[model samples]
Target: MSKVLSKEFLQRWAPLIVLFSLCIIVSIINPNFLSVRNFARLATSSAAPLMLAIGVTFIIIMGSIDLSMEGVMAFCGASLAVVMLQFNSFVEWGFLAIPVAIVFGVAIGFVNGLIHVKLKIPSFLVSLGIGFSCIGLTMVMTGGVRVSASDKAFRLLLTERFFGFPLMVYVAFAALLLAYFIQKKTALGRNLYAIGGGEELAHASGVKVERVRIIAFALAGAFYALGAMFAVAQIGSVASNLGTGFMFVSITSVVVGGTALMGGIGGVWQTLVGVLIVAVISNGMVLVGLPTYIQEGVLGVLVILAVALATNRKAIQLVK
Candidate 1:
């Protein structure tokens, strides 16, 4: 019994343990990697990707993928930029623009979900197409140029620190709490797990699989929009490439956190840890004098290895 318990504990916390060990090793190699200032920078830099990972976590829990994060974020960021910057004679409302971006995110996500569920299309292709379409729209709207905003209050949300922590960290903490409540206290969350376990069984068991899926995707979209807002607020500008690499990074974080790509398991807490691990690795690499290109290669290799270790190969057979 003791051995079984030990094994269970190891399985659950192995990723976190490894992550911390890596941090320690990196700090030893470069003392700057453990500085307080660097820690603050790491937290702020990770805020956007952390939110994106949380969003994708929902879709993964529903046994689906959302490759549309980049597009959704780009659209949201672009919309916020145009609205607040008065791009086309549109009136600017300081804080109100945030909700408008979120709404557009939900609408786009709903359309993506509709295409996947109603049209019986795979989410990968559907999301890819939709993401490209959003990019095109952004280019057209901004004429392939950057959009800048001058809202000082809006910028403070991303720039200001409370008790030595960026305001975005507080927002991420709130989002994490909300995700936890949804996963543990809501019927929709249970239904999502059931669907992920077995879609046909869930359908036969009276779960509104389609509705749950659609809602999950929509929520994911909203989160992506929120992340985009953070990006814009932090930088005080928006660009077409604002979300270009987010989809890959977010998915990588979720998978590294021990969330099975096959779904029906894991939660926001795991994702938070995973995001921290990834953030530390990236930050540490720079401190250790590794070139940016080499760091990317290392990240790719680490992602592949982490996924292999986290996956339960015996429980779920590879479909392809």
Candidate 2:
């Protein structure tokens, strides 16, 4: 009975409970932590990581990892600023820049999927190579200079608030909703879990594992593109390192949200809670006056704890 209860607790309530505990601690340390203003700021800050987490959620669910988002995001940010209405821009596509950037990212995703699925390359190696290549491309594009695209309209996409929250928050919310829809309502989503849980069995059952895997990476790419746009909107500029820290933060969000690194056991809602936890921790640390350097330690400990709790139920004889 104790074992059963603990398993249920870990699976059904651990992430939420951890999130609430963090909220309570932060609110106690800084009474103003619960204020609407701070929450709005938190929402804005979390927008980019949320999208990245959502994108990778499907990939992780399919028992694969893609480390190329950081590169993809940086490349897309450059593309958006260069093509959109901006200072020093080569074109003035205005709103069209967003979709164009997204498509560029999708193309990259398709390549990643193809190499991994068809060539049988490890997803990890493929994504890492792609990410490095993208970073190189970004540096070449800008010649080591940051591009500032202070387009008022683009800024408005992030600055304009409705119901006390920025439009960027709504955009992130929409992304979450769409991710949930995909997870629950689509065959692609279903195949992802099947693949993760048991790829050989899923393939034997006619799940078309390769096709599903490719599409999963493609979806992840599309989300990475959107995340790049939001990142630029939040800063009003595009830098070669605009995606500098996304890989760690997004992975941390996915892990802290109770998603297994081993895959097949989590969904978008878990990732959303994870994103909020990360945002709050990042913001709350400042409010409570924790030293900047110690924060990484805190996050690392939390991630370890989350992973330990999640994978504790079963033991593996071998790990690659």
Question: Which residue runs does candidate 1 get wrong by more than 4 Å?
Answer: 1-8, 87-92, 316-318
lDDT of 1: 0.84
Sequence-dependent TM-score of model 1 = 0.94
- State each model's C-alpha RMSD to the native: 2.3, 2.1
Candidate 2 lDDT, tens digit per residue, 1-320? 79767776767787888789999999998999999999998999899999999999899988799999999999999999888844333334577888889998899999999999999999999999999999999989878898887887788878798988989899888889999999999999899999989999999999999999998998999999999988999988887899987887888899889788888889999999999999889898899887756766777888788877777455677777
161 Cα displacement, candidate 1 (Å): 1.4
TM-score of each: 0.94, 0.95
Looking at model 2, residue 163 earns an lDDT score of 82
**Candidate 2: where is the Cα deviation over 4 Å?**
1-4, 86-92
lDDT of each: 0.84, 0.88
Pairs that clash in candidate 1: none
